[model samples]
Target: MSINDHRLVQCNEKDEETLLIFKKGINDSYNGKISTWSTKKDCCAWEGVSCDNITGRVTELDLKQHFLEGEMNMSILKLEFLSYLDLSFNEFDVIRIPSIQDNITHTSNLLYLDLSFNSYVSSLSLAWLSAHSSLKYLNLSGIDLHKETNLLQAVNTLPSLLELHLSECNLNNFITNPFMEYLNLSSLLTLDLSKNNFSSQLPNQFFNQTKDLTYLDLSWNNIHGSIPHSWKNMKYLDYINLWSNKLSGEALVHLSGWKQLRIMNLGENEFSGTIPINMSQILKVVILRANQFEGNIPTQIFNLSYLFHLDLADNKLSGSIPKSVYNLTQMIKFTMNDRTMAVVELFTKGQEYEVQQIETNRQTIDLSANYLSGEVPSELFHLVQLQTLNLSRNNLIGTIPKIIGGMKNLESLDLSNNKLCGEIPQSMSLLNFLEYLNISYNNFNGKIPTGTQLQSFNASSYIGNPKLCGAPLENCNIKEQNPKTPTTSMKNEDGDSIRESLYLGMGVGFAAGFWGICGSLFLIRKWRHAYFRFVDGVGDKLNVTLMVKLNRFH
Candidate 1:
């Protein structure tokens, strides 16, 4: 058979409904990686296109971040063999409802779907996914799902669902329906509802009831009031992020029980009290910034052998950072940026990795913008994978450690508003990847080196230090030497020497006047004779000059 005839023969067995759906997806540019529209058999190798070898069934369809620009269409439902599908990260502008489920019902074997980062409305996709009993994983992030209060009520319909991600979807309307009440997501291991407007009082059973959940993210929302004691039951949860909200009450004692949690971010809230002492055992990353916590961190906080990132900024916490942190050589990333809820991500194998399998906790420690003082620990200079190091807006003093130049991977350094002194290190010129440098508002002196990173920084980054001069300053020649700033000496102020001479002259005149009033020495003949004899004895006598002057007059 001819090649074109052979291609036609291959596609002849596909169901008419499936053929129509595939044609519509190709028309929509959803399968954009396909450069040309050819016969089904000819287009099977296109991006996001997958097929079963024996059955010739189009089973998997993944079109993520493909920039396939168009409105979404329901035609996707016709491919009954689709067991794994991803249409996320594409520019989907509208909803697409197709009579595809009935076709899938005939096939009876579909699983794994991700329509996240698209423009589907809230109830449209959630309702459909809930009804798919065969779906094991569903992700709909950044899609603004806001159609119903009991949005996930359809979840009760699915029994095989294991992972559901609904992050950044708008779930904040007053849907009087008790959405969290009816569902039993017992098999679920991960659920994400972070970055939403959900303000409804969360039912107590929301987390406590989720016994099988291992990862939960409810950050950047309005979920408030004291954390329920019911959360003590989440045994499998390994990560919890509750950042950027208004939850308060006794924090330290309440959070220590999650013995399995490895990553916890409770920063940017209104919690108070001492940092929990025994809390170090469970975590690899702990962020407790922007709260009312106080007192020294328990010395054991550093002993968490798994810990890589520890942030405790923007609090009333006092005292030195425990030196034990230096022992954390296994630590890959450590941060100290000014008070802010850091949204850092950790991945395996970073710059500090000896073996590529080790995990990196970037931006993990932020101790800036607090009352923290004392010299920066040199041991912290070892974290070469750190991205942002902010020692700004604190009372920290002394020179920037020379070892800090070893952090070749550091991007942003903010030592501003400190009592710190000394020249900006010339060794900093070697940070090839270093992008942003802010030593501004500090007591730093000398020239800022003319490297790509330092030269690119604006003059504002070096402000408030009159002693500092270089590329940012007009008078660049002052690069000669950075002088140690002198302080005023503590000595008594005295009058000028010229003034003292005048005082001495005045004293002599007064004494001479006093003697004249008592009896001028000239009036004392014996005194006069003694003075004349002494004068006459030395060199030529004064009388000889006097006689010469008399002879000239004669």
Candidate 2:
């Protein structure tokens, strides 16, 4: 055989035997995944295997989520040239986690290892991990690490580690050694210790050495107390989530130093005091809901040009919504192309929804369940791209603005449980995309506006407003006044009788006067003759006076 043929033949012998051994350990049901792993073909051509082009040695094995059921065979580490190995998300019945001490020489070339989500691996001892000094990425998430005592210290030995995920590992021992103040993994960029039983104050200096960390999630833990001032050194942080913890105090003042921060979630905590005023301007998501924050929503928040999701719900905040909310130019026009911005829990459509991927046009402003008062700002309607607007459970008053229809993208709206009144604006019916609406328990009056979208809601949406009527409610009716008894009808008849009596009395007085003058003269003949003789004598006296004057003038 020629030299090239001899080299190719030599590369396939040992590694191929090791791979066939790894395959035999798994149940026969998953044979299809490695069906091509036969002695006839070179091992480098097998499925889920990659070999270095020149050396013809297997370098990567990726069988993630293949549902291969079997006990882990530690002999796979015998792939001396392997650099990457992922056997995650499989039904491994038992895992004999490797202690690098037993096979140090075989694992020196390994760089990436992911054995995450193998729940059957009940116990872990990371002391063995210190042997893999060249390891960079390690994910043991969803594995039971309660029995592991040296998790932090062993992980710290990995100087080249860039990302570590131990979430849902039931890790309760936060600091195994009180003297170990800071982690030694200075090259780490991402760390997720969430969904663990970390019931202690945030270690003051635990993160001091990881100044380059850009993402940190300690959410879903019992971690209490204020954020340590030492954390301000992590200026490169881009996202931090401490949600569903007992963390408290007004120490958010330290957040202003994180100029690179973009997303912050402290929801469901005991955090009190006003929201920090000097928040980073480039922040895209701010979720401080269900806390003890009391005070006006700082007007400075509206100045954040890139803010798209602002949730201050279920706080004690008081005061009118700032009219400056219209200044959210990004929410009005800008499209957030990054779909993985942040996972948010929002109260919209009268319920809480855990949103995993915020769509490009999904802008939300949730200020519900506060002591806020004043008319809903008309200027707020300028956010035409907004999808969820929840201003419910407040003291808001006045009519819904006609411009509300301009927010055409609204999918969930709640103006319920307020003092808002007047006809639900006809413009509101123009919101064709509206899916969930609640205007109940308000002073609103007039027919609920007509539209398939508006009328599609249940009558409960229009309840508590006695005067609000239309489809989805009782029709408007004009009620007439009724007389209680005949007395009221008789009063009308008595008015007519008084008018007839007054006319009769006036006729009698005129007839009596006529009889007293002419009738008496006719009846009494002697008095009549005296009246006529007196009349004739006056007439003759006037005629004689006129003749005497005429004769004198002539």
Candidate 3:
């Protein structure tokens, strides 16, 4: 054979030959269009190159984000000393796909391999990587593997895999036998399969199989059904997100098993019933909105000492503001929207006033469009970092609190469709960050608050009160002569009362009027009879005198 081949065959080559193999592999990535170095010695001087501190052997090749391009070189694949290889995010794209048939056979010492976020990696299979006997870390996320066969077979090759990320890989169908056959990721600590189309209900034995899983995300899928009771067995699980699915049923209880859990997003589901009491203590960012849940606000739920964002909007929850909620001192975002199944819209429902140390970190609270009646809770002003306050579409009465101006960072305020009376608070104008304000459909009667922000608000923001006169309405602005005039009030009231009394007296005196008419007629009849009788007598007397004269004549 050749002289170098003789030296390699005899095991007489120097230690520098191993690094040359890696350098040559770097050259293959450019397809001979570019060099790995300006001069030959720069290959050893590369940033991520690591020679074993003992053997001077090139054991690591980490060229992350170095603007490298094209398929990995076949000539450099002959390196047998590489232990850690990370070629992630280096603009890897090629017109023609590369084949590893010859390259994978030569380089055999590779353990940790990461080729993530590259466009060139479209179709992958475990069979292709079957020869990598020592691989432990394999991250192929953001690679867009469309078909199943490529990845299913490829992932089964690494027996010592400790970390694997197949997120956003478009994998949904039931992964069968040969796919998971050799895949025993017992050492795996993190597995992210998020945003995939995996619709099948996960096997109940899933968590039981993965005892070491720490951070797992199966979120943004179509997986439904109740949270498995065995889910708590994943003792090492910390970050779990199954959000944006079709899951239903009551809240998962005793999340204490996942006591270290940091981020949990179970929102956008059909989960019904009350929020579980104990889960509040373990969560940091809890999102459970747009579900079918109902019942009273659990007082202990507000005790989540680490809550930063809590979203439970569009669920059927009731009761007034429990002063216990202020215990979530770090809460920055909280929403309770459009489900009026509550008793008191505000605090008048005799909310037990146990004001915990209010966390000035709260940025948003939305309890809008609920059956929440009574007055708006004055305790709401305790949220100094409040950014958005939406309490619209409730039976809430009373005046808008002037203390709202204390929320200097408030950007949106919506108090529409309430029974609130009194004038719009001029203190509202002090909110410099307020961009959207809707306070319509209230009984507030007084002068419209005037300022640059107030003037910009249209008349629609101040509708629904007839007594509210001095607005932009042309007829309402001109001062009237009748300023709470007394004469008009007395006349209107007296005339109304007199008409009512006359109708009542007419109905009651109907019999009296009839008897008076009948008695008067009877008296008149008697008088007529007596007068006629007198006349007849006078006539008779005259006639008698005539008759006597006539009789005497006869």
> Which candidate has the highest TM-score of all?
2
How do the residues 494-526 of candidate 1 rate in per-residue lDDT, one tens digit apiece?
335667889999999999899875574568888
Which numbered prediction scores highest in lDDT against the true structure?
2
lDDT of 3 by residue, 81-119 (tens): 777878787666532223545444564787888877766
lDDT against true structure, model 3: 0.62
How far off is residue 116 in model 1, in Å?
2.1
Clash pairs detected, candidate 1? 122-145, 335-365
| Model 2 score (lDDT) | 0.81
| Candidate 2 deviant stretches above 4 angstroms | 1-13, 28-47, 53-55, 98-107, 334-336, 341-343, 355-360, 478-554
How displaced is residue 466 in candidate 1, in Å?
4.4
In Å, residue 460's CA in model 1 sits off its true spot by 3.1
- The 10 consecutive residues of candidate 1 with the worst lDDT sum are 347-356
- For residues 404-457, could you state the per-residue lDDT of candidate 2 as single tens digits? 989888999988899999888888899999889888999988777788989898
Please, what is the whole-model Cα lDDT of each candidate in the order they appear?
A: 0.66, 0.81, 0.62
Q: Which should have the higher lDDT, number 1 or number 3?
A: 1
Full ranking by lDDT: 2, 1, 3
Q: Where's the lowest-lDDT run of ten residues in candidate 3?
A: 340-349
